[model samples]
Target: MNNAGRDTRQSTRFMLLYALAAAGGATAYVPFLTVLLPVRVADLAGAQDIAWLAYVAFFGAIASSLSNIGFGWLSDITGNRRGWIACGMVLSCALLLCVTQVQDLTGLIAVIVVWQLCLNMMLAPLTAWAGDCVPDRQKGLLGGLLSFSPALGALAGVVVTHPGMASDDVRLMLVAAMVVGCVSPVLIMGAPRRFPELNQPSAIDQTPRKARDWAALTPAIRMWIARLLMQISEAALFAYLYFWFRSISPGFGDNDVARVFGLVLLVSVPFSLLCGRWVDRHNRPNLPLVVGAALSAVGLLTMAAAQDLVLAIAGYVLFGIASAIFLALHSAQTLRVLPRPEHRGRDLGIFNLTNTVPSLIMPGLTLAMVPLFGFSGLFVLLTALAVVAGLLLVALPRPK
Candidate 1:
């Protein structure tokens, strides 16, 4: 292979391994948040399950939001990504084991808070590490590779929730073990050191730019807003999906919903990968992001209008595919917008607010909307948000 071909192969290998690490890290605790935590809350709280779940989610979100930024900043200062990632993986794994011992809502909440902290300590640095190493041209391909993260997250849920698992403690241990297994490769091999220039922002021009000079910053800001809007829609729908499905179709149980969700994620994997490849090959990354948002709007509208399970499932499939593409692609594109490579970790941490802030807002949004206009109202609101999300991207100036 020529040097270019060799470099491409190396990038592909790194991205795939990185994606696997991301998937494993995600699988470790995401299932717990989406599935097991609720069950545990119900088990511990009885009639107060709903309220306790809210509390846990509220605290967990706060922990996640703060830790993501804090740890990312810490990584920036230390100029080390792998060490933080490795330490975080180990810490989170140990904490996951500690969770198995928590017998009450308070104890569980405490453990989850600590788990969120450790998880982000790993995740934020990992995200910044990508920006440090991956060239801009390969970002779309990287995003496509990242499509596996969600699939792995959903699959983790399915595996841990299996009837054969039988014991909650055993399931928790398995989740931690899987985290270790998945993250081991990246930790052991480590990422290439970031270019020294990427860690020295002071050497670059620090003067405020005129309007003409603002071109580079505009897309990044728009992308941030775009992601925030889309995530709000996703968070609302995801948190309430089970209840919404139950209300629409009484026969559908937790397992049924899980299966549907997992299938949707699985189906989306190829489409997302294809979209990423297309974006990279065509050099039209922004267009697919816009399309993904528009598709999400259509899906939300379909669900809002539908009164039956079939229609709802169809809507979910569309929305799932769109969300998968949008998130994966957006992630890759984000690396393009950072103004200062030296502050990549901190900047990415700030960008992650789009991910975490929505969690804080969605619960309240759901509470307010569901009572006033029901799921239909919520979907309609989400549809509008998706539309706006797409439109915001239109304002992004084309790459020079």
Candidate 2:
């Protein structure tokens, strides 16, 4: 094969590998955060695990948010994302084992805080690394591929938390092993130097720009806020979907809910990929987001109005697929608006705040809204948020 063909093949392979590693990164947290942490907190804190979980969550979010930006910038200076990722993978995986040693909520909190810090060390650079290698045209497909991460994360949670795992230590060990297994392939077999700058030599940029103030970079900021809004809705549903379902029907089991949740995730992967390819084919790049946001609004509306289990599930499926499309494609498209190649890590870190920030927002929002108007009211508010998020992109000035 010619050089050009080789580069194409390598690029394809790199995207696939990156997607796998990204999914692995999600596994680093989703399973533990969703399943094990809660169980551990309950075991330690007993009746107060809810409060303890909130404390761990609040502190953990702060730790992750700070570390993501900090390490992303560090990677920018070092030009060694892979090295940082490898180091992070090792350290964070070690921290997973530490979770097994914690005998109290306070100790668990400490381990979680530190683990979050180590986890984002891998996550931050791993996120920015894509823009450093892949060009804008292919970012859509990359985003489509990235949709796989959450699915795998959820699957990992299911696997390790299965009834067969009788002990917390065993579960934690399996999680660490899974994290290592999922993430190591990329570190071992590095992205081909087809895009040499993806492997830029160690160098420092002492100047970190005030990226927020730049007029030219305004679109990226808009995209960031838009994403944060949509994510808030996602976070809310994620935390409360079970209770919301129960409110509809007392007989709805966790397995039924899980199947519905899992099916939506499975369906969204292909839907997002199709939408990503559509955007790539046409120059109407923001069209999918606008359309996705509209559909998300409709989905949320459907759920709010749903009177039966069947209707509620249908509405949730719609919302799930639409929101997934918006988020997945929006992520890849954010790369287009980032003005600084050298600062890709830093800027992407800023963009990623949307992910962590929602956790901080959701608890307060849920408390204030759910009690007043119930889940239906909350869904209506989310519908409005999604609409506004879509509009932010719609009103954005087009690139000349």
Candidate 3:
């Protein structure tokens, strides 16, 4: 092929790669909101003891974090990200399908925990794949593509099919998983090979090469910490957003709440892509992150104090825009800081801990705070988390 032809083909391939990664990521995240899904299921079934739902959610969180670390390390050793990614995607489908057979809460929680564990194996590696091969200049666009997660999750939230309707969640879950899972491997199959020799590097090395590698890796590490904190705030607020809203505005129903999340997500998509593209163009990842955090804090504080549903919904929109920007920029920014060309999977795995850790911590924190200060107290705590996350980014050494 001519040079121009070659360039066109390469651009096409990268676009495919971005789509596959985004699709697979959406599948992984779609099931994560199952906590909310089950709540609807329970309400439809006329079951009570709502607290069990939280337990199931916590179990899933722990499993997800553990799997992220394990599968990530495994991908590092194998130098084959697709193998594990495909496995996790398939396994999550099976577990999600099995969940349909459960009639009791124990069965429900058990299947969910297993499904979540398998699910993370797909997620941690899939996300790492982008960092493994994509150039730094494209990180922003990668973030923009990632906005598909919430969009997909929101769509999944509205189910014409439930368990009573022949297990709609499973049907959608399997279809989405298969499509995304199959595409993931095909897109990355031609990714430029790196670290042909898969030997483990010593974490103990003190050589200049090792030091340089460590320094290069700090941006990802610091961003991971920031993600963890931001997620803590986000998770805490989401975990109890309804309760908080109910206490302040008891009349709000499912339709109203759905509208709130929907509008917020709608406003967020463009903002997410815009921040990412701007950051890529300017090479200014940290600035967006700092601004996003501050904006999110203001929104959270507004939600905490608002008495009118309109104000709360407005707050949610602001929070969603900021959160979207934060999520996109942080992911792309981490790619810029990865140290080793060969071990992107390993480092990105560690980096994903920020995403998973808060899912585990936020629930407990939310529950503990409820009795002490109630819903209002949760927002104050969320603001603190956001502020700290912003401060951490500010403290990071300038990216080279």
Q: For each candidate, what is the lDDT?
A: 0.82, 0.81, 0.67
* Candidate achieving higher TM-score, 2 or 3: 2
Q: Clashing pairs in model 2? A: none
lDDT of 2 by residue, 175-238 (tens): 7888899889988886554566444433434555564347557888889999999999887777
TM-score of 2: 0.88
Candidate achieving the largest TM-score: 1
TM agreement with the true structure for every prediction = 0.93, 0.88, 0.83
lDDT of 3 by residue, 159-195 (tens): 3223343354555555455446545565446454332
Each prediction's RMSD to truth: 2.3, 3.8, 4.2
Rank by TM-score, highest first.
1, 2, 3
Q: Write down the worst ten-residue block by lDDT for model 3.
A: 193-202
